[model samples]
Target: MPFVEMSISLEGVSILLKIMVTGKVVAVGNFSRYIEDSRKEAIELISKLLGVTIEEAEEEVNITKGLTVRKAWLKTWWSPNWKSKPFTYPPVQCTERAFLLYLLSYTLFVDKSGSRVSIALLKLLENLDDVGNYAWGATALAYLYCQLGSATRVEVLQIVRYLTLFEGWVYEHFELRFATSNAKYMDQLQPRVSRWIQKHETVNVGDKLA
Candidate 1:
């Protein structure tokens, strides 16, 4: 049996590499329900990886949706590779899990800010590179900041600091795999600060420097 690490990119949004135990497949029935369960499991896995308490992980992932397994094939979101082969699993690989957390964090921060959720997100996708788990971490951090906005309440700051520290720790994996220039990525991500600043034109510098 070959223990293969396969790196797959999906629709330019995110990249996921799985270490598959080949010939070891888990057959699933009721795609929708299974898919939802898969997502929850993915979050739990990441939370475990990040060493977050169970309570904290639950607090972070508040809104979980239920899916119908019979109708799973109908929705591409449930399928990691919508255009490619169908996955027997809900496709909750490490990369996908990271991306989900990232988006959830972003939504929290952005909504916390004054910008309407729609407009804030409309800006996030611009120049967003959908590569590597680190990119997902960056995106998630951005979202957390958006959810936190300029006024970082004590509790929100704690979450932001915890996640940002985790981001620094996990970034090495992506650096080894992708080997893209850090300077370049930093440059790309800097634009997000401008967007944040725009929202807080009159705010103090200390408050907005996330």
Candidate 2:
């Protein structure tokens, strides 16, 4: 929520896209089906990316996050604790794509299940140079907006879009006294979200609305 404004403009949405695509998408396709069918190959590529063996990759799919979620876990790709592997050339590109995959999953296009991500997205990373070719900001806006609309139904229990933009918009447009101000905000030249501490998230409810 730090820098994203969620305005109805590319300028705002582009901040969300900065995680990569400087993009990935989900849809019905034969290519996507092919990617799903080749999940083992992906796990193999992931083993190389993580500097682990195939059996280790299978085990890592559960052990890394400690969540036991029975899904594809991407933390090693993005977490700070993991050490970098020494790769000559091609495998390094695989590492970069894996990191992008984590960013995309954890941020914009995160699966509702949280730790899992669709293998189909890996197809986009096959050509790293072309990932940025699409209008990712626009695409994310559309995707988020669609999910938000669907969430308005009475039967809907949750909204799946990136909530940071919406949270930042609320804080920016209205005076929310719950959040602590970041004194060096202007000096940091970060997003408007940098202006406040996230302490507001846990502040107890009261009659105070702002």
Candidate 3:
């Protein structure tokens, strides 16, 4: 059966969803007492305007990633390719593939019991270019990595490639500007940075120091 994926966008936030309708709303409901009841009424109105039965109108409701808006789905007969149609925040091929690899590696190898993995993930995110809700996605990834800390070096290295790809594409190729605007900020941090260097602390990636 064909499906209608209803996506809603508000102030650049978008969510694609699937929903199933339970029943028609009969009353002009108050929003305060029971918000769900009011929502049902609103959906019924939408269903009538769209020329579909209420049952056919709600198939799934999903809060898609990188979005702040609400979306409800009304499945309808349409082309099978509808699902393949790209959303606004479509995944970039290289970046998405790299991220997937990293996730798999984390699942297989990372040991999840300490703050080390969390710190690493946070550092990776802090270094990435913030674009198109990507920071949010990265934050989510960081949380996952932090939570799943049983990962081995092999898996982490695999994921790091994706992170490096992001760095190269978003940082190097795009020539994006850093948020730092003041020379004073750099000057103030220089001494602390010197101390950090003197401490001889360095990140070791695989067998090499980064």
Candidate 4:
């Protein structure tokens, strides 16, 4: 996700995405068009994914969202041995899909609150095989651009986007002459972030935004 220099209009995103930036918001495919489900269906899917009963899923959803809107908390509820881990009774394929959904929520489509995520996204992840075919990168880029625009407001407090992509783009496009070289960095397979992140140290991307 490297960002090249587009000195005039910052139009490098088209080159990076390999598609023209359309005024109609990405002209990729007819994906995610009909990916909608009822709250009851989402709750049932969560129950299956987390190996919990519908009652427990409903309760957790209430606790996380204060009501059963299309959002769920991700912080304390889903991390550190989250109680609703996918059970072994379902197929391992189910577990894989659950993990993939969680991973996407935590990374690409992460919320600015850093705690809750839209349950609407789960519908998009319902079909595991077709997940890769969606214009996920384009969606992420669009969301990131939107967030960037909103962040320019005078009353803005915080900004949230795929900072990994931002930082990776910086690392790839610029020379890190002042930064320390990573001894364990693998030139072939490792991401650019590996050169900056130290082992056993968690870096918060938001804290250093200034």
lDDT of each: 0.31, 0.52, 0.26, 0.51
What does candidate 2 score in Cα RMSD to the true structure? 8.7
Evaluated against the true structure, the overall lDDT of model 4 is 0.51
When summed lDDT is taken over every stretch of 10 residues in candidate 3, the lowest stretch is 11-20
TM-score of 3: 0.19
In the range 79-126, model 3's lDDT, one tens digit per residue, is 224345542322243233223223323332233321112111222222
Q: In model 4, where do residues sit more than 4 Å from their true spots? A: 1-3, 7-38, 48-51, 66-89, 175-183, 191-210
Highest lDDT scorer: 2
* lDDT by residue (tens digit), candidate 2, 107-205: 556546766665455555666776665555565567778888888999989887555545555665667777567677653235444555664332211
True-vs-predicted CA distance for residue 62, candidate 1, Å: 2.9
Question: Model 1: residues >4 Å from true position, as ranges?
Answer: 1-40, 64-210
Clashing pairs in 4: none
Alpha carbon lDDT at 12, candidate 4: 45
lDDT of 1 by residue, 90-153 (tens): 3344334334334433332323222211212212332223222123333433444454464466
**TM-score against truth, every candidate:** 0.19, 0.60, 0.19, 0.63
Query: Which of 3 and 4 is the better model by TM-score?
Result: 4
Instruction: Give candidate 2's TM-score.
Output: 0.60
Which ten contiguous residues of candidate 2 have the minimum total lDDT?
201-210
Supply candidate 3's per-residue lDDT for 204: 15
Better of 2 and 4 by lDDT: 2
Tell me which of candidates 2 and 3 scores higher on TM-score: 2
